[model samples]
Target chain A: MAKEKTSALHENKGVSQPKDTNTRAIKNIRTKRNTKLNTKALVASILKSDTVALSRAITLIESNHPSHIKQANAIIKACLPYANQSIRIGVTGVPGVGKSTFIEAFGKYLTSKGKRVAVLAIDPSSSLSKGSILGDKTRMEALVKDEHAFIRPSSSGDSLGGVARKTRESIILCEAAGFDVIIIETVGVGQSETTVHSMVDFFLLLKLAGAGDELQGIKRGIMEMADAVVINKADGDTLKHAQLAKVEFNKALQLYPIKASRWKPKVMLCSALQNEGIDSVWKLISDYIAITSKNHYFEKKRQEQNKFWLIQTIETQLKSHFFNRPDIKKELEQQLELIKANETTPFAAADYLLNL
Target chain B: MAKEKTSALHENKGVSQPKDTNTRAIKNIRTKRNTKLNTKALVASILKSDTVALSRAITLIESNHPSHIKQANAIIKACLPYANQSIRIGVTGVPGVGKSTFIEAFGKYLTSKGKRVAVLAIDPSSSLSKGSILGDKTRMEALVKDEHAFIRPSSSGDSLGGVARKTRESIILCEAAGFDVIIIETVGVGQSETTVHSMVDFFLLLKLAGAGDELQGIKRGIMEMADAVVINKADGDTLKHAQLAKVEFNKALQLYPIKASRWKPKVMLCSALQNEGIDSVWKLISDYIAITSKNHYFEKKRQEQNKFWLIQTIETQLKSHFFNRPDIKKELEQQLELIKANETTPFAAADYLLNL
Candidate 1:
């Protein structure tokens, strides 16, 4: 197989050879190797909280410029020993649930308690615009000014789940940088919430106080995956409704089978704008960790999550590769139209496309 | 690719060079071609309501006798024009919802209305049996005795979804066998429900009325996919509760986005044993067809379904082929264990495996 790949690459090169092509290829390969080595050294320095090196390393990893993945892998290897020390939390909610506002207030509370906090926001829509709401540091003024807090908004390009992959890798980098907590904030779409939950230690679902129909609109699968539920914006006139909504949610959650950890998820009310109940939210998560770790379920769960992700990543990549093949793409489109016209069955169409 | 495969076959023939091996290979190729022709002929006879040929054709399709897939595709192609004329309804609910009993009663109703009915029961647990529950036709004595009703049960397989694929193909065969209505009965398991829904024209979710946590136990996504919600066993003491459940489901359905058909799904009560409200359920389906067809949504939805199955089938086959490659298996397993240990990110592991 390796020989086959090499031969294919050579064949490609043979087809494209022109003046300076060989020299350009050699130069490209050398630069890629050097970039990888530099990124590794930069990552090691960042572990000691060198902000300048950390920023540069992240920029190199995020770039689509040549050899970005090679450099990214090297940096990740160097940072491995210092990573996995933090509590990874993922927060998601429906649109208009004040997710950004809540995160700013929550980050401030963690920093106040002498904890170094890292925030990675994944906004799927920002992929095209590359302009994220959280990218504007002024929006999160309090936490942004805190020396212990670091907030990096999502980058452009890729699916919501792709943004999640980058954020997950960033969490390891942040943990290596001595951050005690890594918070992943996702765009409040249902599909994105599932992606965020798969990568985090604890998944927090936020809800508005009195959104009756909105509660129903949220899929129960998303709710069942939640480790903690926070009724956000629970202040003043919304206080009574928040309490009621909490009870309803608790009742709904009771229908699900007990989670593997055997710990019943906690439901709490929080006013993210007023900074109320922010401490309680962190305390609940600490309690959850303590309980699961004592039972040795924490390590087991994380290991299982890693296995899930490994299979998922392979499947996704293989699908992309298969679809990207020029011949397969054209055949697939033609066969689809044939099936639509009832000139063929899906099974036969599949056989033909796969053989092609 | 075709030339390579043919050459590989020629190489195998050369290497073996045994009289018995040569004879067996010749026989195998002959049986494959013969089966294909047989299936094509069987499809025509089946459409004329030749029950014996229909049974034999399905047996030839489901057999693992080396020539099955070729024969299956031939039968499917011959049946293509006749299939899709029937309303393919997929029914699922929890165990107590009485799926088998409901199917028996429902089949009887359709047969009585002069609509030849076919019931295909997909039991995920059948993987170990290599046999079907329909062998005990006594369980559905009334429907089994009806000249217009036919019942076939699940086939053993490695994957639940794979088993479903064959069953769906069998549905097309049954439609060609002059069955005007095909009811696919699947187990109540959530994952299997999605598989069955993807292949059918309409999905009916059956629920027992007295279940206290009905709304919470069934995910909203399942409800959204359902074209109708039936509160089954709605006789005698359960009548009032069934009515209440119907109202609850109706309210829940309102929260979902309107289905593409723009024909609002209805909630109804039925007692399959008592044979109550079966006609009304049929009427509701007919009404749905009429409204959706009038607006041209029916053909559009069918086209989208065809495209979905075409892509899904291709992806499934590609994954299976890639994983089944002998040389890659051991390395893949080793990498998986490393991934489980968190020694490497899933993305990096996938890159290593695919590029290996």
Candidate 2:
């Protein structure tokens, strides 16, 4: 039995030799061919507004894939002219402000008006889990079924600001796909909200009817940037509270110097769940665009937003490069330990690390 | 007289004699020697804990004179070992939160305990006017009379953060001069508060009673970093409101994850005008330090702060360098104009500038 098994093993080894070599060649060929094909298809499909293909293109951009970046840039350049044609609106509020419901209701209204609306929810939660809920579509069942309405949740796995960048780029793709309005929905109010605000043409801040304490927690600088403040969940028991909040917000807005747009930021009440006051919010936004565009403030604002993104992008990249250097990293750790031991000052440590 | 002056001018020009050159050279040498002696004496006096000398040292640091920086660095190094010994406390609140009054009361309390205290006030408004009020000492009449107390105002010019860096470095000098506690007072809540907080061992956020809106405007992240939250003016009609604020803050703090120190943040009510609750605030800070130090969290926090500073410094310098570049500046202006004209997108414009 041993002799027979040995003969069989030897025979198998001899037979596998040529087959292994042939298989290895075929596998390499297949991989190379698949990569090339994927790239071509991604570019073409993204141009055609295929959601899956656009997602893949964004993934390529986010992953720092060298080839993907080159192709992404090419696709962007091709789609650039079609971009910046849509009105980009940024929506943000604290957690539990019914952001998803509002977007769903608002998107439905726009689609009903025969306008294509694209809802791009920039999820800060995406950074922790490489998966985004992309639940806006599921929640906005009415809007999801509309052929003219598109819903894309944030692609997870990046900084909040980085996610905003991808979403901003995706906005361009959406615009090229012929969407008339692009709404960027952020998960919560904070730095991410500011980031989204910096990217969009119109910023809408959603708030709940609460005692003025919540208002105090909102950064005045952010409030100053809002084009409109909507008190959401203004229905039933919340109606009186919402009205009070609207009045309080109006007073707070007055403290801020008038914006360059010459439009007093309007405070309005809305109920996303009941689908009440959605049309009024849209009308107010339309009026804002008309007034500001007529005064040329709209164009000026777009230009400012562009300049901000430009500087922000460069600064982010420069910071990443500085932090990524191996020697700098080691020296930084050592210096930090020294600082921890109180052996050296933070200023001196900074100087040493920077010089290093 | 004109003829005499003309004759002297002619004589000086015509004289190629060594005597004339020697006299001129002697004058130049005299002035240089005088300058050197003055600077050395100034630095020596500053090291001796003389307020006038300290003022001179700060001036030298702020000046553009090439030798001034070297002299300043030498003095700072001499003072370094004595630094980080003091419990550096940073106090910040909105304007009219009685920041000065609170510091005055707090400074007196520390002095009463036989502790030497130094107050450094960072006034962001001073940057534009090139003058700082430096009113902490004046406000704390009792503390000012105490030989163990010192007060220094922020220097004008540069960003608030830059002023903070200088003030932080100055604290070392003050501590070296034997101050046991250093209080950095900031007007209004802003990035300036964050800057001061980073340098200090304890951060005290001052809030007014019934300032719910103001409280809400304060970002949770910043609030999470505080060692203690003090509701100031907790006297008369404001007393109840202050107590209520304390409860609200305690609730708000629970939302944040456990801080690095593992010390539960304390919220206290204080009437700075009455000098009531000042000692409690100080006690809370001391308790925080003691507990955190025993657990070795104090050292860990300082290390994290140092790391943050290093990255911040590099970012600042890089930003300055990028903006200061002649070519980049030119391109930025051109791009701004193009963006204004809607001829290019901001992201593309940035990419172009960065590549250039």
Residues B6-80, candidate 2, lDDT per residue (tens digit)? 543364446555656578889878877876677667656755767767767777666656666666766676566
lDDT per model vs. reference: 0.80, 0.78
Task: Name the weakest run of 10 consecutive residues (lDDT summed) in model 2 chain A.
Answer: A8-17
Instruction: Put down candidate 1 lDDT per residue, A119-160, tens digits, no spaces.
Output: 887787676684675766667788777788888877767676
Q: Which residue pairs clash in candidate 2?
A: A216-B213, A216-B216, A216-B217, A217-B216, A217-B217, A218-B216, A218-B217
Pairs clashing in candidate 1?
Answer: none
Best DockQ among the predictions, by candidate number: 1
The clash count for each model shown is: 0, 7
Docking tier of model 2: it is acceptable
lDDT of 2 by residue, A58-89 (tens): 66656666666666666666666667889999
- Please compute DockQ, using alpha carbons, for every candidate against the native two-chain complex: 0.42, 0.39
Quote the positional error of residue A54 for candidate 1 in Å: 0.6
- Candidate number achieving the greatest TM-score relative to the actual structure: 1
